[model samples]
Target chain A: MSFVSLRNVTKAFGDNVVLRDVDLQVDEHNVVCLIGASGSGKSTLLRCLNLLEVVDRGEIEVDGQTITNGQVDVNALRRKIGIVFQAYNLFPHMTVIDNVTLAPTKVRRVSKADARDRAKDLLERIGLAEKADEFPDRLSGGQQQRVAIARALAMEPKLMLLDEITSALDPQLVAEVLTLVRELAETGMTMIIATHEMSFAREVANKVCFLDEGVISEEGPPEQIFSAPQQPRTREFLARVLAAGRL
Target chain B: MHEVLQKFFSPHAFRVSLPDVWTGFQLNLKLMVIAEVLVLVLALAIAVVRGLPGRGATPLRALAIVYTDVFRGTPLILVAFLVGFGLPGLNIKGLSTLSNFTYGVIALTLVYTAYVTEVYRAGIESVHPSQRMAARSLGLSYWQAMRYVVIPQAVRRVIPPLLNDFVGLQKDTALVTVIGVAESVQQAQQFSQNNFNFTSYVVAAVFFILLTIPLARFTDHLIRIRERRERAQLT
Candidate 1:
């Protein structure tokens, strides 16, 4: 069985359907990149897997546990699946170290000292060690996004979801965040990254899934999807991204 | 100029009334401090109840809504009279025996809590929904998320406005004089009635200004500092 599985997952917000009969599977330690246009349900799909949004239909299992069912402890399940957002929603009232340590100390019951140590290590890894005492508002957008990633990493999650994490960064800062994700991929972390950065997705994704509207129109190894996409919609989307010199 | 000013000001009468007003001012300060604490705690509780999510909290939400609307709409002085005299008049065994001062505190706390609840609710709502999402996505339970993440930020943002309400509450302590609690305004009025001079009222006004000016300036200082920090962050 795949480490993460979504079977016939459907979600709607009032009258607007966001995800329609979606089915996907990701093996352990694999990097799956979800590439699509804006409003194509990439972010919503990631939200559902983390239980941030409930599915109107179908089931989601992470590591053989059915996370979508109401019987599961949602909070405990969330601890196993970390998600980073496009806007870098760091707790502004907290210092960078506090933001990183909060979940570990509060949710996981890690000792304060131990959480601080782990947060420092994560900050150092993200090249934000010196910013430990600084509040989120003081940091640049790129730095804040990195700290957000570190905040997620502190949980030691089994599967990490990146929801267009670089979409909010400046063109110059995008490379730095993408490089960090590439390093995580190298370290064998299972990740499903929703991204608009075609080149970064191509470089890091083991399997690339092209989403059109609310469903995956085409999915394959990066080389196959990028060069020889079978679906016309996938080809059309890629042609526009390529024309924009993004791939 | 000095002679003309002295006729209206009556510095001698003002000085003579100082000790008397000081005692009464002390009572006002005491009420302000105690009621301030109670208002902060009670108002936050009410705001949280109104903000509670999902269908299970509907009745509680409705109760909180009614409470805030009723108390906020009623005049504070009327509330003072009702609690101070009316409750005791009902002759509920234990409640009837409580001092008028305690009733004054209760009345002020209830009235101020309603106003503060809306301030707190506005602050709590101003925090971007994404903050809740971020906190929850980290496995923090709903209450845990609110306590550790949301409330702290909300309280910080509302501090200036909260202080403004506190200043208003401090001044409104004089309103309890109508309930016969012998606060500064009442003592000043008694002195004026006896001596047939209004100078004691000036002393009471001075005491109130002295108490509230620092708080008002401090609130302004906090607002300035917050503005500067936000502006600096934008750059």
Candidate 2:
């Protein structure tokens, strides 16, 4: 069994099928990137992995545990995985430090002091230590997003999911957030990124999966997938990304 | 003009009725305070229950929905009569013999809770669903997400509206008089009937105005602060 595995996973909302018969595997500490067009099920796939959206039919096993089983504890399962969003959904009412420490203290039952200390350290690492006491609304988009990443990391999750974390950022601000992801990759934090940044994927991903119409049409190493895509759909997506100057 | 002022706002009537009106107003104050606390807690519970996700909570949500719908539609005076006189008429032993004050509290609580529950539900809905998703994605349970993230933002955003409802509650405290409870309006009515002048009613209105003006201003201040935060990203 791999560190993380999804077998025949399918999810739908009413008549709109978001994911269908998706199979993927990730070894511990490997950075896998899912690249595709919008509405291609990238975000939904990550959401299902975290159990934010339940799979209509499939088996998802994380760390040898079959999380898709009905009896599994979703909260405890989510504690092991951290997922960040494109919009950087930091709690607007909470300060930066409070946002980071909330899950550690409330969900994991860590002591408040310990959570605060860890949150402070994570903020420092993310280069937002000075913005600790400031409310999220007071921060710039990049700063808020960095705080959000720190908030997720504060829990020390086993696997991180980055769901187009930079898609909503200003073009100039994208690098700072990606720099932190690269640093996390260097530290060997296992991550599955759903992103549109093809060049970033090419540089940072161990493997890339091209999702087309709710299915992983092709999967392989970044070098192979980006340079020599096997499927025509993969070629077309890369061509479009290239034409848009993203790759 | 002087005669009109003298009839409605006479010094003699004000002085003669001040003591009695003030005493009666204390009962109104008590009802407002007690009812406000109960509505604050009970409304939030009903609102949360109404918002619980999945089919498992269908019955519970239905119950909460029915409660809000029934109470929201009933007039406070009618509720006061139903609770005040009707409960006693039910002759349900221990509960039937309860004081009119307690009955007044119950009526105000029921009616105001329905109104406030809608306010709280509106506030909760105003918070972007993404906020709840982010909280849940971090391993927080649904209630935990509501407690630590959603409700706080929702409550904060709706403070002005919540206070607006409170002003309505404060005013409606007078409705308890219909239940034969001697709140300020009833007291003022007595003095006005006896003296054949409405100055005592004017005196009661002044007292009510004093409390609500401050609340309205505070709500405005909070609104201004929130607006500034959104517009300028201020600290």
Maximum-lDDT candidate: 1
Tell me the tens digit of each residue's lDDT in model 1 across B1-235. 6754554368887888788988999999999999999999999999999999999999999999999999999999999999999998998999987888999999999999999999999999999999999999999999999999999999999999999999999999999999899889888888888877778888999889998999999999999999998898777
Residue B118 accuracy (lDDT) in model 1: 100
State, as a TM-score between 0 and 1, how close model 2 is to the true structure.
Answer: 0.96
User: What interface Cα RMSD is found for model 1?
Assistant: 0.7
Docking class of 2: high
- The digit string of per-residue lDDT tens for model 1 on A11-60 reads 99999998888899999999999999999999999999988899999999
**Candidate 2 residue lDDT tens string, A27-139:** 99999999999999999999988888889999999999998888789889889899999999998778899999999999889999999999989999999889999998778
Tell me each candidate's RMSD, in Å, in order.
Answer: 1.6, 1.8
Cα lDDT, all candidates: 0.93, 0.93
